[model samples]
Target: MLTNKSSSSSARLTFWLGLVGLPIGIVAGFLAGASPLLLCLALIVGAALLWFFTSFEQAVIGLLILRSSLDLFSGLQLPSAFAIGINALTILYVVVALLTGKAVHTDKFWWFFVGWVMMQSLWVILLPLGGLGMGAAFLPSAIKVWMRYFSWLMIYLLVMQLKDRVPPEKLVSLLLLSLVAPISVALMQIFLPASILPSLLTAQAKAGSNVSGTLGFPNGLGIFLTMFIALIWWKLSTSQKRLPWMILLGLVSFVFVRTGYFTGIGAVFLLILFINSTKITPIRVIGVVLFCSAFVYMFGSTEFGQQRLTEIYQTPLLNPNIDISRAIILSYGDGNSFNWRLAHWNYLIEAWKQFPILGYGLDSSPVLGIKDFRTGSGFAPHNDYLRFLVEQGIVGLLGFVLFLTVQGVHLVNLLRSSPPKSDRRNLCLLLLALFVANLASMLSSNIVDATTFFLYWWTLVAIAGWGNEYWQTHRLTQSA
Candidate 1:
């Protein structure tokens, strides 16, 4: 009855929202003096509302639209506007929840809380040291990084508090919805003329090509796609529903090649096959074979596709020239690039021989010319772990490793105690996928993209604790 009441209330809310939205949209169209396209969009919204009778987070969408408009006026970019809108909505949601006394912290809050406290405390400690200017050069970039971290941290608190507010089905739905926008952008890129394709691609290179989709980072885009692919595969293999998800999966895979990160495709196939084989039937086996065949046909045909596979195959085996081979591999077999990462690692190890204790203060490496060793570019090591070793010395790296070790150990214990059939399994799978992706990313990128890194990291921390929360909830319900 309560469920129905909520549904009915939600339906009524949608009706009123649409009823109000139509005229307000018209007023907006006239007052703002937007283009005909904007006018048509407003009309389309009204039509969609009338036809579908659907309820959406109208307030949030309106906020995003307003932000985009503001950005257009200010000559700021679209992605920046989108990011601002997300941050604004996320913070507003958390604040409102807290004010309404609905928010609660998770058991894992201590991990995130401590991590935040440490970062803040370290910043205070490093302020007088003046070493932070080295690697973290620009004031805007540095502040933006911290702001991203803090925004995601707050988002973590919201998720931890509202775990019950989102059901498994809802979670699945949200994940699917998130894919729609990106998938659309990716498809547009795929279908666009060769002349226009370059303009569409974001700055980040997925397969050493400028084909980044909606996400700024190519690897980030791939990682996000892999997450959805995992979810779809899970649902297709486990749930009775298959056709809808299977079609969606196919569509996603096709657009996936737009980035040309074949590794992501390979990872998806391997993980899906591994999970599906646990209960593999004749039909399932045939499905896997068909998917793999399609993947190969589509991906292997492209120049970027052929190059990635070639690189993987040509990745030099260990020999007396292993360092030389590695340098070639990192630079995509280019001998002229100088590949400073190796030299960066060598410099850090050599420096550790001196002040291994506290070493240089945070962000102090560039000041000492750590980056000037090989490339003359004065860049940090591409590898996050190596960067940690360089900047923090042996002690700081160990501290970071210890932090990760604790998280890993805790996850293992939680998974071991969790029943196989429980929803906690999803949490475990998601975390495991994220962990693997982070690990893979760090081998080549920086810690800024890794396990302990961004908003997603904090969100995962809260998610890791959800298993125990759900278990407790289940036990109480059973008792009742």
Candidate 2:
């Protein structure tokens, strides 16, 4: 009787505490205003509390959701919220883990990865003392640029630490869940009234009927949806409930096609080829042929698709009737976005000739006033490879290449060694497909600039590495 009374008293006390604290917290938030620093502080505190109470897997899922859906909160004018919240949570999690003696042990692969990242950071830090001095005015921009690149390193470390804590299946589920909001918002944009939708979530007029979805640009949306198609395709292959996944795949693919981004389409086609490389059976070949035929028929029939194809083959400069000057002017105008990219690539090559070793430093293109043909103004090179070549130079470029090569090798090994029907093997195949898709997308689009896609890419890379190590160790233990 006494125990029951005590339990009831405790429950009442907890209920009262929640009732009082909820309003107090709301009032405090309002009183604090929406200053970036204050908002960051509140987010950090809330995230820290969440990290402490929840499993690391849950925290990771929440972080990914925030990273992906940040554009939804742009109306609040808190552009830095996503970066600040992510970095704070990551730092806090690392600090807590270290203090509690739960720090993840590293292997040689991690050491090499960290060393390469540090080398890039060292070059960026010494930039002011080197070629172009970093001005105080440009310091913040440089830091933000550095942070954008460095966050991938932090993501890798976080995933490595949680490798043992979270199961692979759980991680996959969380990733799919994180994608839900962005995909839903993208779908809603097609049907919702323009006035009801956030401006950033809707397609811009300049995109020429291509939908940008929540990414604010057609190319960004293309990269994201293409990756989703690859992932969902793999899921459908393995899942018992195929209908739902097929529906999602169709929706995302339709939106992606509507974006009119050729790179994404090419990437998906390449992924399909890769998936069927080992199987050349008659039925498989027929299926592949039919799929390609149907896709081509649908795409070629669309007005935007017809226009894009015409632009590719019919350059105004190639016309014999136009004078040289008139041809140049016409080719550089609004109708020739592809020609603009070619011009930007040419400019980047010339810039690379100046500082071929350790280029102008991170984020130096805007600072140094690199000419962008796209807008006849200054902007970073649209090509990621070109950006690296101009910003970090040959050493940085090589290091990045090595990082990618190592990941590819690891994934291939994992796929070859794992059982064909195992979950891990399917995941490896999916990651490889996504990697190839993004690589193709990066040729013309700045793949890294899309925060959600970039984060998703690196997270998959880290998870693949962690899983490879886990399975290898398990095999060894079994043999012993």
Candidate 3:
């Protein structure tokens, strides 16, 4: 009884409605289930529905996964069985995608493969007995290796597909929100009689004794907020971006100061360099004076600021007392920890002689072994490059160097070709901030262990691709 046009309209409406309904239903069903296995299945179903029905679903999922990853160090509170089940679900999703021929392709496959090879290379290089002793001694090494990179690959694939769908503004918004959400929640928790705030502080402080900030020892969160502020400050000052972000940054800074995390002070200075770099005359001088005065006032406070101030400049290594008032310095005028880094680097450098090709399997540090290193609570080397050298040997390190070098060169070229006043300029600034932040994190903390490392690398690359596309489109439009 209906015409063809009416029939088509009905089908389209039904399809659109289903698209919205299915994802909600799938996610709800998954969360509603008490059984871990059933929940995992529901997550997979939700993943599939989201992937198929939404345009920016990949980016959304990627961000969700990354946001969830802060839990990597924070206890999941899930049973071991449940964790394994989730891993299985992830694997199943990948396999299903491949079988269904929805497999995303990328020219960057080699770079991804190199990442895997680097992990495998660890097996042969670091272990003294050529990794044979590792399996018998540490069966869990295999699982740990998978845990580090599997989700990363899936996220990369998802990003590759959804790169264009995630606008630059939205990307910026997500980061701002990540910082704001935690700060807001933590602030409220401070007033409320909640068990979470105390527990969180205790755990995070133990992980790194130097942490001090409003959200309990704010090592991770502080660094994260600082980075976001830098990015947002640049965007807001340079472009007509949203005003809420400026307000958000102010709130975050207040929390950082209130927490007494001295590291955030350094991070704020680093951010200021980019934001106020152009102001060269009276304002710059005034800013510097104000900064120094504020720093002194904050440092002078005993009850709130003393603990953080002491941790800020306290150097490890060479100092007999762990709580030295000032950073220890060697006779050579280097920070004592600076000397230790050189010493450890030298040790790894010498060890590379034995296995120049494949060094050692994943856990090269003492924390992974039976005994802790002299450095205290030993784990992997704090330096990402050194860790790679120790674990994967020269071969894997070489591949990584090449990959990063090419990416760097590409970024430089892109920046040079684009106009300074263009929107694409923000990408360049973001890249610069990330490059500096990651470099600093590598020098100070174990970058790879922090959830920051994986997210930073993937997000930078995705944004780079996004910028490249925009540049190309702009050129085409001008030509037309």
Candidate 4:
């Protein structure tokens, strides 16, 4: 009876919306002399927005899927004012929930990050008043950069809140289901000749120059894949329908091999060794590791991988090398290479010393530019550690440290409380492994604000976080 009533209401609402919207749209289109395509797109977007606002559950699920997939039009050159994304939508959702008095929850890591962003904002806001030469013009860009992390906190909290409303398995299932689009694109990249496809959609030479799917670059795509695979690892542990997951697992693994990101391999290696304690034995671990290593060696060692390995293994002789610090001064030309990054990092450290405690204000590191060997150009810091110290100073670094510290607590809590081979315990292990891989990757990659990667990563974090509390309370009380 309720279902029928809901259906009847939805039907009437849609009918009214179409009736009202169609005439307004036609009039606007006619007045503006708009094309059919433009009008149609507007209508579709309008309908989607209406649906998104009207239905909370479906809206959140759709947002997850869309975030995992593409803003297929993202690469297009558009005005900043026209931009809309998961980050923007998150703020809107939270605001509406608050205004409507809808209940929400936050987790352990939320306030620390929010507090940090607030502090960072202070640095940005104060720099102008402090006569730092940088104007308030930078505040907008700083907020934009800040939004990525802010959304990350919201996503983690939102998922933790959703635990009671949605089943844990279903949440994991949503993540698994999110894999289809990227996987299909990856498979397409493998079979199709690269000459025909858009370069923007593919990986670089180091990553086989074929597959990145919807993700714009190799490392970002690799990170997302590693995170999602870790989520699947949690689900696979206790699934009765093992064959389907195993099949999906095989495909993701095959694609991971094709990704050719060194980190992905290392991440999988970690998972194989320590996914769950009860399921782990020295002999079994050794066997599986060897098998995977052997298979990867046989299948994953493409021409690019071999050549890349040779390059990395060969030592540089600065005496006769192009990469040698020939000039005492570094220029923008000395960019993107490993030596370039080192030179740039040294420069940032020196510049950071000028404003050591508060640093050169927020977002001030890169714009310091290639002032001899004193700073990098308008490029990412490439090392998040340096980015924190140089940009947000000690406060930023401490906030980041505090955020990671909470993860460590959760890791210890889950590992000790939940038994080996159990769902919650395995999930705990996967989150820690993924977090380690991400941190290690951060040593060389400016992945702190990698949007697509975090969309998947925080989902895993949220799941593990919610489980941490639920299992601890239940098990401890029951056992006592």
lDDT on C-alpha atoms for all candidate structures = 0.54, 0.67, 0.52, 0.63
**TM-score of each model, in listed order:** 0.66, 0.79, 0.65, 0.75
Q: How many residue pairs clash in each candidate?
A: 0, 0, 10, 0
Error of 3 at 312 (Å): 7.8
Candidates arranged by lDDT, highest first: 2, 4, 1, 3
lDDT of 1 by residue, 102-151 (tens): 33455654565557536634533553556432333444444544455555
lDDT of 4 by residue, 1-480 (tens): 977866765676566667777888677677457577766777776677668677766677666776656633455622122223544656666665564445567655566657665655666667667734356777766666665556666677656556666666566677666777778777778888777767655534354553676665555666777777667655555665657766676677777766656645666676555554345557656757664776478334665455545434322323244443532233245332555566677778877777767666666667764544454337778788888888777766777777677767766675676654456666777777777776777776777756777766777667666654454222211100
Model 2 lDDT per residue over 1-480, tens place: 977866765676566558868986886688478576776777777667766546667767677766666655556745366666566667776665554444464545567767776776765566656553343455556677777766766776667776777776667657776566666776676567667876666636343466666666677777777767777766776667778987877777777777777766778888877766654677767756776666666667767877777765544446456443443355566566566566556667777788888877777665343354567667657778777777778877887788778767767886786665566676688778777766776777777677667777767767766654453222111100
- C-alpha RMSD in Å of predicted model 1 compared with the true structure: 9.1
What is the Cα-based lDDT of residue 18 in candidate 2? 80
Candidate 2 whole-model C-alpha lDDT, 0 to 1? 0.67
* lDDT at position 199, candidate 2: 62
Q: Which has the higher TM-score value, candidate number 2 or candidate number 3?
A: 2
**TM value for model 4:** 0.75
lDDT of 4 at 168: 62
**Better structure of 1 and 4 per lDDT:** 4
Candidate 3, residue 226: lDDT = 60
Ranking by TM-score: 2, 4, 1, 3
Residue range 178-242, candidate 3, lDDT tens digits: 55445655465445454545655445443222333332335555555666666666556444454
| Candidate number achieving the greatest TM-score relative to the actual structure | 2
